[model samples]
Target: MSILVTGATGTVGSLVVQRLAQQGAEVKALVRTPAKAALPAGVTAVPGDLTDVASLRRALTSVRTLFLLNAVVPDELTQALVMLNLARDAGVQGIVYLSVIHADLYSNVPHFTGKHSVERMIERFELPATVLRPAYFMQNDLQARGAIEGHGVYPMPLGSAGVAMIDVRDIADIAASELLRRHWAADPLPRLTLDLAGPDALTAASVAALWSEALQREVRPAGDDLESFEQQWAHFAPGWMAYDMRLMMAAIQQHGMKPAEGSVQRLETLLGRPLRRYRDMVRESGQLKLG
Candidate 1:
């Protein structure tokens, strides 16, 4: 049976599709535009939108497993429900959902709330499903490239809060493996949710230090107050998104965002090796410039 990957053009979803295809699985990628989907050679591209049930149904025609990842948008819960209903109707056996860490704790963040809603829906459906609650993406560091290059600084409101940031590629690997594994591979197909994280926790300052060492240059950490940060980002992000970002940052600052012990072990067990570290991601992305 083929595996259908939603949001196939996104950071994690794209890697999931590519890895599944590389592993010789019959991969079907659901993309909003087939013209722009540069999927791997053997994967099939189907034009579909997660918000449109008809499009999702068309994409799930013969697929057995699905990697469901959606972008944050207005009415995300409604759209997710539409997609879930269609998947159920289409007889898809397994679903692997990408969720955020501490989704249960930070219900105020719209994106995390949307993911929690989807998790509940998946449970209600009682279909074979695996939910991966991963920490913040280390790839987010790439967005600071301009700042790193121009001013040698990394700025965020995370403060001294340390988080076990996971690389998107590691999450993709786990998702692909879960989707491809036989139903009876383990009794009852394991638990519903898995918390995937990197090997170590690091604060914003520690991250800046790692980049400084990697680049052989001073990398400062800076951020305005949360209110100011929200106001500044509101100019570029939607109002709701800006608010959610601020709330999420505040939660991270107060709660420290670190994963529980053995979270990384779980990821390592799934991948049969240690997960990639943030420093590795920086080097791989060529963002680490050595003096």
Candidate 2:
């Protein structure tokens, strides 16, 4: 049974495809532009758009499982619901969803709201589903690479809040395992909500310190004020995205995005191994540079 992966070119989805291909699973990747998809060898590339039901239906033929991640769009909920309906019609056996942390509690954030809506739809479907809610990704640090190098600073809206940040690769690894596992049939694949994180939690300051140590350069954590950060982002980002980012940052500050106790156990049980920690990612990526 082949596995179909949506968002096949994205950060987490791309890694999921790679891991599945490495495991010898028949992997089919759905991409809007097949030419741009750099999927690994032994994987099928199907040209499709998630918003188009016909394309999705065509991609779902003979696919047993699906890895679902919505594209960044205003109509994400509508597109996801349409895709879920088509998957059900095509007899897809299981679904693994990559969603944001605390999506249910943050309706003010449009992206989280979209994800929550999709999760609710998945719960109501006959198709077994597992939802993986991963905390803030380390990849977000890459967005500030230039600034870090130029000004010795990392500007994030996350204030004094400590978050259990995870690497996208770790998230992908867990997802690929779930998609390839055959043990779900006996238990019917519980509608699980997995909270994924690195081995430890770190505040913005602590993250900068790690980067500094890794790169042997002094790095400063900037943007202690939310309004200033929001205004700066709004100058370049779309209104909706800027607003959502601000709200998400605020939620992180107020509630702290750290994983709950036993989160690491859940991750370990799912992968049958310990999760990768932040330091491992720093060493592997070699993106951290010190002043």
> Clashes in each model (backbone N, CA, C under 3 Å)?
0, 4
The digit string of per-residue lDDT tens for model 1 on 1-291 reads: 688988888899989888888889898998878888898998999988877767877888988887888788888778777887888898777788887889888988888888898888878867678988999888887987887757988877667867888888888899888888732244335437888788878787888888888878898887636897689679888888888889988888877676767777777887899899888877777756533
Model 1: CA > 4 A from native: 182-191, 287-291
Query: Could you report the Cα RMSD, in angstroms, for every candidate shown?
Result: 2.2, 2.3
- Whole-model Cα lDDT of every candidate shown, in order: 0.81, 0.82
Clashing pairs in 2: 215-290, 217-290, 217-291, 218-291
Query: What's the lDDT of the predicted structure labeled candidate 2?
Result: 0.82
Clashing pairs in 1: none
- How far is 122's C-alpha from truth in model 1 (Å)? 1.7
Best by TM-score: 1
lDDT of 2 by residue, 232-270 (tens): 788888877777788888888877776768998878887
Q: Which ten residues in a row have the lowest lDDT in candidate 1?
A: 182-191
